[model samples]
Target: MCEIGGGMNFKRREFLRIVIDAIDGKTESIVVAHKDRLCRFAFDLVETLVNRSGCQIIVANQSKNAPQQELVEDMLAIIHCFSCRIYGSRHYAKEKVKAKRKYC
Candidate 1:
């Protein structure tokens, strides 16, 4: 009864595969530690799918001492994404310069 999602690539997530299976009548209920722990985004769509299938979505840590954990994690994910975008653009620019130099 344990599933580990390696990263927040929602489309390629193995845990989401399980959720889809459960929604298709393979399981009775879907329990999670935190909603974002399973997905960084599009949780509403997942919740709707689970609801449409009449499956229960249980939150194990709905009440906690540190409520900022979710906020911090989301912030980190956003920052990581932004940084990667900057890195990729820089990399692409360098590659383009190299290509132009080679052509010239």
Candidate 2:
């Protein structure tokens, strides 16, 4: 089986390193637990890898030859990141309100 790492866990540089190392060997594929694990920058990553390494990425949770995987993954990543940002903003707003009430 191909070695796997997550973008959520590893920084983009680390993810790229892992991918490059995997491609340097006789590995036929790089397996990710999910599509987003491969990259939040899915299109660019795929294009670069396909051009440079010629190794395919297999998202273990995805079906073979899924045509929309890249687009779907990118959209999902955007949504997830946006949600986190919004949640953080809301949390900070709530904390600010509580602090103002306690002090003023």
Candidate 3:
């Protein structure tokens, strides 16, 4: 199990690519500091790897075959969705502010 990224350094797309490549026989399981470090994509990626690559992931903090996988995936997805909504709202607010300032 190779840890892919630090908390600040990790990006979702890179993580996905790493997992996909690992499943494609390029590497083994990806390791990370925590379950959330792998983010919302873990559930789908795990299923893909299992179906397509015969690969299994090893989350260093969690045991292999841990029952918590499903729960963790759900939590991560919720957090990601919430963050996206917050970010979208912030962007919308910023745009509105800019337009108001320009028009006024």
TM-score of each: 0.59, 0.46, 0.52
* Cα lDDT of model 1 by residue, 9-88, tens digit: 67665776777886897767778887767677777887788778887778787756365986787789888978888999
Model 2, position 77: C-alpha lDDT score: 68
Q: What TM-score does candidate 2 reach?
A: 0.46
Candidate 3: clashing pairs of residues: none
Residue lDDT tens for model 3, 1-104: 34444333335567667766876788755566555566544455464664476566555786464568767856676787678779999999999999999999
**Residues 1-104, candidate 2, lDDT per residue (tens digit)?**
34344345445565656666756754566667766556645445563664476667666786464669756865786788788889999999999999999999
The lDDT leader among the candidates is 1
Q: Rank the candidates by lDDT, best first.
A: 1, 2, 3
Best by TM-score: 1
Candidate number that wins on TM-score, 2 or 3 = 3
CA lDDT, every model vs. true structure: 0.76, 0.65, 0.64
In model 3, which runs have C-alpha deviations exceeding 4 angstroms? 1-11, 41-52, 63-80, 87-91
Q: Residue 97 of model 1: what lDDT?
A: 100
- Scored against the true structure, residue 83 in model 3 reaches a CA lDDT of 88
Task: Give me candidate 1's TM-score against the actual structure.
Answer: 0.59
Stretches of candidate 2 off by over 4 Å are: 1-35, 43-65
